[model samples]
Target: MLTIIYEDEQYVAINKPNGLLVHRTRIAEEKKEFALQLLRDQLGYRVYPVHRLDRGTSGVLLFAKNSAAATPMVQAFEERQVTKTYYAIVRGYTAESETIDNPIRPDKDHQHKEAQDAVTHYTRLATIELPIAVGRYSTARYSLVKIVPETGRMHQIRKHFAHIRHYIIGDKRHGDWRHNKMFLEELDSKALLLHAYEMQFTHPFTGELTHIAAELPENMRRLCLSFDWVNAVTKHEKLTDSPV
Candidate 1:
């Protein structure tokens, strides 16, 4: 059963597991199972997705039970009123905090020179060094960061981190293959180490402030423990103060 994180008459949210598609798409037609279908079957009623999480990224996924709720939540996401926090394990130690403001082209129009503005704020929760060496360095290093995306462009987090030279571990696309190989060979990890940890927004029906969060999946938690970035990384959140 999918782990339900938050539920009310207006909407329900779940801690979506990795490798699960929010819904079937033309590109991944072979996928027979989907979050929308599965949740509807499990709940015995239709669910409307107000927002989506990438198939490879595991964490909170919200759905509106009725049309009235879906409209406002969709607008909230579009206008960037909702605050989002993500935890990522990236190569190299990052600064205590940083903001990435870069323009990115949509995948279909990547060849075009023009791009949409994308911004993300991130804070380093902890850093660790491993004795294993992969490249020119004698050691390997990684950082656990909590990120707040100011704009939700496609692949913004993955591409932004890649542009800054600190690629997220196990991200096959928009990441270093060398780091991906190292994580797979040494850690037995191939899943992307990016989690959509938390979201905050004003409730659509009740107008009350709402916040929801999901624990990092087991693999991600295990990786964090390997680096001893425990409680801090799990509790690290800096998303709300700086919205849009």
Candidate 2:
């Protein structure tokens, strides 16, 4: 069963697990289970997705209990009124805090590829250096980062991080293969490390400010614990405060 993080008469949210699609798509037709289907079945009613999270991302995914509530919620996201926070484990130590202002293709398809303005702000919350070596390096270094995107283009965070060469760990498409192999083979960590940790927006039904936060998935939490980043994992204030 999906973990419901928030619920109301007009909206409901779930801590969507990694590898679950929000809805059906032609690109992944072979996949059967979806968050939309599972949640609708669980509630025995229809739900409308206000926004989408990547299939590999896990965290607070909100759905409107009815279509009336979905319109304003979707509009809020389109107008950049919603504040979304994410956490990621990346390949190297990121800057104390930085803004990535770059352009990215809207989607992976090459047919209509056009670069669009995308901006992402990130702060490094924690860092760790391990003696384990994957390639030529004698040690491995990583950082836990808090990410906030000013614009929501597809794969903006991943691509922007890749642009600066601090590849997000476990990102198969745009990450360091050596580190990915090391994590999979040595650490047995295979899921993408990016997670949608929290979302804040005005409630469409009640006109009240709403904040929803999801706990880290077990895999990412365990990895953070192993790296001695317990404070970073447990404290949201640290994620938003002065960078480490």
Candidate 3:
């Protein structure tokens, strides 16, 4: 069953699991279980997706009960009025904090669409070193990062991290194949190491402020437990002094 994080007369939120599609798409034809369908069935009513989460990403997902509410919720995201906080495990030691301002093509085909400006701010929460050789290094180094995107673009987080050479763990499409293989072989991990943990926005209907959060999945928690940063980060309630 999908975990409902938030719900009201206008909207409902679910903690989506990795590899689950938000809706039907041409690229993933084999997916018979979608969040939309599962939600509709579980609630015995209709649900409209206000935003999308990557198939490999797991965490808080928002949905509107009707189209009337979906419009404003989607607009809130497009207008950059909403704040989204994501947590990721990535290869290499990322800086303490930095903003990635890069333009990304809207689609693979240049003729179809022009590039859009995309900006993402990320802060390194902690670092870990494993006694595993990868490439030229004798020990593998990784960082736990907290990311905030200033603009919404397709695959922005995955692509922006890739652009900076700190590919997120398990992100095969925009990540290093060697690092991905190592994670799978060593940790038995299969899903991308990205999670949408927190979101803050103004209620489109009630005009009140709303903040929702989801805890890291067990796999991610276990991975971060080695560094002992997850407890501190979670207990602190926020990443203070972050550049993002």
Candidate 4:
């Protein structure tokens, strides 16, 4: 069942799980069922996706109940008015707080024409000292972070974090293979640690501000529980210091 996080006359938002697609995509043809389809089935009505979450991303996903609402919500995203906050377990001890303002370009021959401007703000919530063997006679440590992307781009969080040298754990495509393999073999975790925990935006119909939040999944919760800085960074009710 979908965990309804927020719902109103014009839109309904839910906490989407990891491994679910927001909608059909040409790249993932094997996905016979999608979040949009499932949501429509569960609600017994047609719905429109206001924004997209990566297949591996788990957290607040907003869906407009009708076309008129979807258009404005999409415009809000395009204008970077929507606020999003995410938590992630990365591969190193990050600084207390930092902001990454870099522009990303599509790789050669890939989809999209130009390099887009991407900005992300991140704060180190806590650092864990889990000792794991890396290559020959080497032990490695990693950190946990709360990330907020100011501008949404394709894989902005993942790509930006990776570019900063602290790739998120379990991000295979742009992550350190050694750390990925270590987590899988030792910790038995295969899913990416990134979670979209909180979101704030204007209501399409009422124009009244709205806020939605989702708790971290069991795996992430448990992982954070095993650390000390967890209480310092992870226990807060909100991810962002500023009001949405």
lDDT of 1 by residue, 1-244 (tens): 8999899999999999989999998899999999999999989999999998888899989999988889999999999999999999999999899999999887763666678999999999888888987888888989999999999988899999999999998888889998889899999899999999999999977889999998888788877766666656544432222222
Residue ranges of candidate 2 with Cα displaced over 4 Å: 108-110, 236-244
Write down the worst ten-residue block by lDDT for model 2.
235-244
What TM-score should be assigned to candidate 2?
Answer: 0.94
For each candidate, the alpha-carbon lDDT, in order, equals 0.89, 0.89, 0.88, 0.83
lDDT of 2 by residue, 132-189 (tens): 9869999999999999999998888989999999999888888889999988998889
Ranked by lDDT from best down, the candidates are 2, 1, 3, 4
Question: Cα miss at 70, model 3 (Å)?
Answer: 1.1
Measured on C-alpha atoms, candidate 1 has an lDDT of 0.89
Q: Per-candidate TM vs. native? A: 0.93, 0.94, 0.93, 0.91
Give the local distance difference test score of model 4: 0.83
Local lDDT at 12 for model 3: 93
Instruction: Please identify which of the two predictions, 2 or 3, would achieve the higher lDDT against the true structure.
Output: 2
Best by TM-score: 2
RMSD of 4: 4.3
